[model samples]
Target: GGTIHIGYFDQHSENLLDAMNESQRVIDYIKDVAEYVETADGTQISASQMLEKFLFPGNQQYAPVYKLSGGEKRRLFLLKVLMSAPNVLILDEPTNDLDVQTLAVLEEYLEEFNGCVIVVSHDRYFLDRTVDRIFAFEGVGNLRQYPGNYSLYIDYKEVEAATKKAVAVAEKSKETSVKPKKSERVSWDKNKQRKLSSKEKREYENLEKKITQLEAEKAKTENELYNAPPGEVSEVQKLHEKVESLEKEIDTATERWLELAEINS
Candidate 1:
């Protein structure tokens, strides 16, 4: 097997703190990992410069580790891990206690990281921003792999559920059609009389596909909004409006689908 170096960041910082000297300044703690680390673009950066990049300014870098806030400690731990320059990074609930600015910086860092990242997080926006594939746990000992981001995975599951429900409805209809009572037969005749027209039937068949497409588009737009650079206020607003519009479209199509399904049944 090939050799792999793993850098891990846990949500609970106590374990990491116990291994560190509390009196050490943040810069010293980071320098202990490395005096300088190379960036993705081949330039080497000093510990202080790297700390600044991670949102620790010059003043904050001189403070003792014990004086840092909970969120700051977590951010420091994350920076330490990154400074180690491991090939594989494992983050367990890395978002806990982290401020939004830190989270955004981490997201940007991950975008340029030249390594594999395995994250266990419940933050949907984080997952959407950082990951391209998902491993979803369905039940005990049942983990399934999906070949897309979190949003796309959710879309697939929803479509699968709808298809299953349609199949169940068709089976029930078949079972009821066999040897129905007189009143039941009359009800069946009424249902048949209200069957969907050719165009309606086509629309019904395509609604699921259409909804899936719309959902995917909405997911993409939301991701764009998340990654949009600062000061692009107008662009952000437009993306938000697009997401709401797609939501409305999905709702309208779903209602129409339900109507056609009822008529056909």
Candidate 2:
């Protein structure tokens, strides 16, 4: 989850291939090359079980580590990290070169894992599954905390942006003043009070309903994308496009709703 599982993120550590060069079978590689340690929860894992889980069974188990595919090596390395049982897992870009099956397995493992996971990733699907809270970097050393999954956080951000735009428009409207004509040399004050007309009230209600529907559609799309199999690239891409389109619709509807709401207030 989060592009990397707990204890699965170091890219440039002592090479996995180096360990491969020293070991024979996958089990031997794990037992002899990788560090074996107990988990923070005091759970101990068997090397054979780990080998079977991380790598394929039968011929692949007995195959030399050097003969394993790139994805296999990465998977094995991830198992090694998990075996170490670190209390805190800090990962950076763990999704590169990983197979979909492996990702599914890793996601399952993370779901069951009991440890602190610190992940820095742009994988929205992963973040949605893994993190309950997000610390979003807003540039220039600013960080904003949101108490929800990525999809909800994005919704919050969109609403916040719309609110800001509405406020700006409202403020700008107040800045306008009637310029006194040079010939008249005088001007009359006009009341700036605004209220929703009967027609406008209906429009406001309709806009609010449209905004709610768009938000629900976006959330549904996000959920579908998150649960979608990684192998279905085209389907995932389509869902992403749907989410983006819905966001735009929501933003526009929200802006109109805000304008009406402010006037009615």
Candidate 3:
């Protein structure tokens, strides 16, 4: 009944407002409960009729791109995706820019969809809702499959990675202690990575969790900032600084995690 594009954040392109034809198709379908809509097709909906009372719930109201709040723009783009009825949805980290309400709307819709849904997300909350299987890119140029939601997959994956890494480290220790042949390379390799050890695995998991929490907190702060009184210069300035700090934290955490992951790859 709907098309869901879950992929790298903002993959929906800026032309969303121009996809009028497809947008109309979606409007006609959801007409039973439709309140408002953005860019879709013209056949199914006129721009004037696109107005919806159901625009994103709470303070995170949906608006046209130029008029939208940051959160609203995020949801509007997602709404645009649903306008194109796709039988098989492709998602890449769909949770990245979503607010909780928007995320819930998507989760509800995807759960009711009749076709297959492939979600690529690092958000545990999202994966637990829409995915029943996990296709994880395990460390060290490996891909592994697990039959469970994100939480289970995380647990299983960390253990597997640790087992592999520890074994590799242990093997290196043995080679050095026993004195391997001169032709043999150093026991450790700058590029060679084993599975993560228990300690390392736990640390990685904690980092991931912290990132998720921080993102949520940052979103909440943004919502508050938008809802603050108009022309509240001091409050706006404070929020801007906080947002800047959050951005830095996000960049730092993401870089470190990728660095650790690349070691195994």
Candidate 4:
């Protein structure tokens, strides 16, 4: 029954990107925090049970899944997964080749899944919408598990990484401000310690202040949502569509901190 769940590229030609994109869409829909799910009868459904009851109902097989443009293919692939009828789904990178419209459809289905879902994606915007938690791949051995969805993950991740970066900067400045730990006896150990002038001292203080303020601001924003209505309609619903914009601020700050770290290094 799941085999009828056709996931194919719309532009089924030599366009490797589209093909890969189609595959990713299907995979991402299966992740642990997914909102969509498959049932015992092999029926794909959402919280509203709209896919089988409406969108692709009445034996309405997917046309775009067989052949279409990159954008169209992505839509079909997502629909297929939404209807695959599984108890648990895992999706990885489901946004490739999707236009804003198709992405919306996929996001809606995800916002609709009910079972355990796990998704692997780098699309911050998509992640912010569809996921409840994040298993972000940081490096070869580091995959940070964030409590909230991607947006929250980004916020928390930035705090974690930025705080580390800010700490590094503070340490470097502290080191530069210190007189070389009483010059060593050996001539080879007599490396000169760079001294911070008065201006540098003031600048360092300003940086510290700015970092402290940013930390407080981030905390305020996060806490604000807790008291402000978390939305009675749905779990994935409260996060307004403007989440992408909100995340941008954090991203910008993270980048700045990273840049400062580079300068200090």
TM for every model, in the order presented, reads 0.67, 0.60, 0.41, 0.43
Indicate whether candidate 3 or candidate 4 has the larger TM-score. Answer: 4
Off by over 4 Å in 1: 178-265
User: How many backbone clashes are present in model 2?
Assistant: 0
lDDT of 1 by residue, 109-148 (tens): 8988878889899998898888866788998999876545
lDDT to native, each model: 0.79, 0.67, 0.56, 0.50
| Ranking according to lDDT, highest score first | 1, 2, 3, 4
Better by TM-score, candidate 3 or 1: 1
Give Cα distance to truth, residue 265, candidate 2, Å: 17
For 1-265, candidate 4 gives per-residue lDDT tens digits of 5533333333332344344433343223333225565644556545334443323432433332333455544454455445555446666565545667666766665565555566666778877677665566777989654445566555555555655675576567545743334453343232222344576556655665666676666566546443333222233333332333444554555555443433344
Error of 2 at 59 (Å): 4.0
lDDT of 2 by residue, 14-120 (tens): 36556456347777766764445554466765777666666568667777877877778888777777776656787666665467888778777776667777767
The candidate scoring highest on TM-score is 1
lDDT of 3 by residue, 6-95 (tens): 332354433443443332333333343344433223245432243242254333232223445556655655655554445556776666
User: In terms of lDDT, which candidate is strongest?
Assistant: 1
Q: Global CA lDDT of candidate 2, please?
A: 0.67
What's the CA RMSD for each of the models?
A: 8.3, 10.2, 18.5, 13.2
Worst 10 residues of 1 by lDDT: 228-237
